[model samples]
Target: MRSLERHRDVAAYALGVLNEADAFRFEDHLMECPLCAARVTEFGPVSRQLMLYRRATPRAVHPLTGPGPRLLDRLLAEVALRRRAGRRRARYAVAASVVLAVAGPALAVLAGGGAGQPVRVEATDARSGVWARVTAEDRVWGGEVELRVKDAAGPRPCRLVAVGRDGTEETVTNWATPGRDARPHTLRGGTALHPDDVLRYEVRATNGETLVTLPGA
Candidate 1:
């Protein structure tokens, strides 16, 4: 029951191929249309799965590069339709989430630490491919967190979220790797909190999956 233009836009938007202007417009529309929003959500992960399948097929080079015309669209649309009849539903490429609308820069220098030394900590995720390091200067009231992710993000978008002691999550940055290769990319976010004000750091998939969390002190 959707128009062809609507379908095309939905497909393009999901694949991250729509031009900036078009994408911005569609995103505005997404805030209003639950159906379109739902469809876009499924395409990212489905595309990643398809990309993996193509790579394993042994004859695919850059197969499924764009979700606009790939098999991902058909599969997700079918699923979305069934769900509507039943149930369902950025990266260095940044989120338009209200929580991050006023976030700080990607990196900030640490200072304070009582004697000009910043506090530092490290933690790794269960997958073992991702880890986070934190450094905060007491008097500066902010810190820098770095994430080194390996072979864990390429098929879908991943986010580094900085959680404050008060439970507010500010997005540090978002990234999606190219193809099935997760060659260890690093993400840095400068948070606006005192060294001790940070409660934890989280690495999550755009789908609301918490990939990992590093406790802060």
Candidate 2:
């Protein structure tokens, strides 16, 4: 059944393999299922590591000559090893989520007590059908940011920028967008400007077109 299949989508969602539609459906399912939410949260670290690795690697194809391809092959082998390890960890995490559920709220409260709530801003570009949500957590050095964006049409490179009140702009992070299948991206970046000093955040394309703008706290 479709509902049962949604239950099975936890791993695919964690691995970032689910298509946009399925991913959205699974996210909706998450609100109704705390166990799945806990599992997904536990799977977060490995998923982030995979995404970081992908960002570091080049997207271009190289000539089939000498050590270049060989080095790439070895890098891919290492990624495979890490992916297997991630899957094993995911399994263990699922088991752990079960234990936490049985243990009740005390443990969950203790685990989550470290950080205060982040300030969040959300906006949509109606013309482009792009949506973005930005959250900022203050730190001594500056501000840590996380962006969740969807419906950004692109086969081009994109970047997130934080605009300061004094008109200075800082490039938070950059990412390559998929051509037709534009799945949601969860990207983390930091800015030297404090959260209060940031005027706004913008998601811009390679051509410098603004897709979404979120005001700062």
Candidate 3:
């Protein structure tokens, strides 16, 4: 039924791959269904591990053929469903082997501890009236940053900046601020600077005004 379809959305939700409307619906469903919510929690660590590889790729290249991220996402969910239904371990192993074969370098990076312990920091800008909580994780090539921002409601464009200890700056990510909905927005980006090398993170408006600044710890 419809509920069963929603249950299968856990993997995509954990991967942050669901479209906004679908994600909102799933989240609302989570409030009522502990089973789906628990599955999402179980998928969290794997989701983070995979996202490091995903974010490192260039945004310009959209592959038209071959198995892509969405395919991998669905595959993972299917594997989970099979396991939950008490399917044989051999089947799960085959599915997982395919994922590992496809994931290749990403699994190597993860196994080598390339994604370090995440550090989280929070800040509120008195002047701009913006509040933010940021989580920074060190990756082999750079750092992965996720921001939860609030109170900067608008149709305005905004960017996240990663400031390095050596005085260099990199634009981690950018998006338009959501209009009056006012719910806290979560955004993730990757930067070339190592997590330890980053001094701070800044949320900036299109006109170059700082909305909030999170000190990197």
Expressed as tens digits, the lDDT of each residue in 1-217 for candidate 3 is: 2788899888787666889888777666765675774565456446555545466556776633355669778867866764454445446656877888897666642221222347788888898778888887755457777878886466455668889899998777655554554678777777778777989899997568888998876
Q: List the residue pairs that clash in candidate 1.
A: 91-174, 141-193
Q: Could you arrange the candidates by TM-score from highest to lowest?
A: 3, 2, 1
**Residue-wise lDDT of candidate 1 within 101-196, one digit each (tens)?**
556566454422333345666666766356555555443224554556664444555566778889876665555433356565555445555557
lDDT of each: 0.57, 0.70, 0.69
Best by lDDT: 2
**TM-score on alpha carbons, each prediction:** 0.43, 0.47, 0.48
- Per-residue C-alpha lDDT of model 2 across residues 99-141, encoded as one tens digit per residue: 9899987775222111234678889899888888888876544
Better of 1 and 3 by TM-score: 3
- Badly placed stretches (over 4 Å) of model 1 are 1-115, 127-129, 135-141
lDDT of 1 at 73: 78
Model 2: residues with Cα > 4 Å off, grouped in runs: 1-116
- How far residue 23's Cα lies from its native spot in candidate 3, in Å, is 30
Error of 1 at 78 (Å): 58
lDDT of 3 at 73: 83
RMSD of 1: 21.9
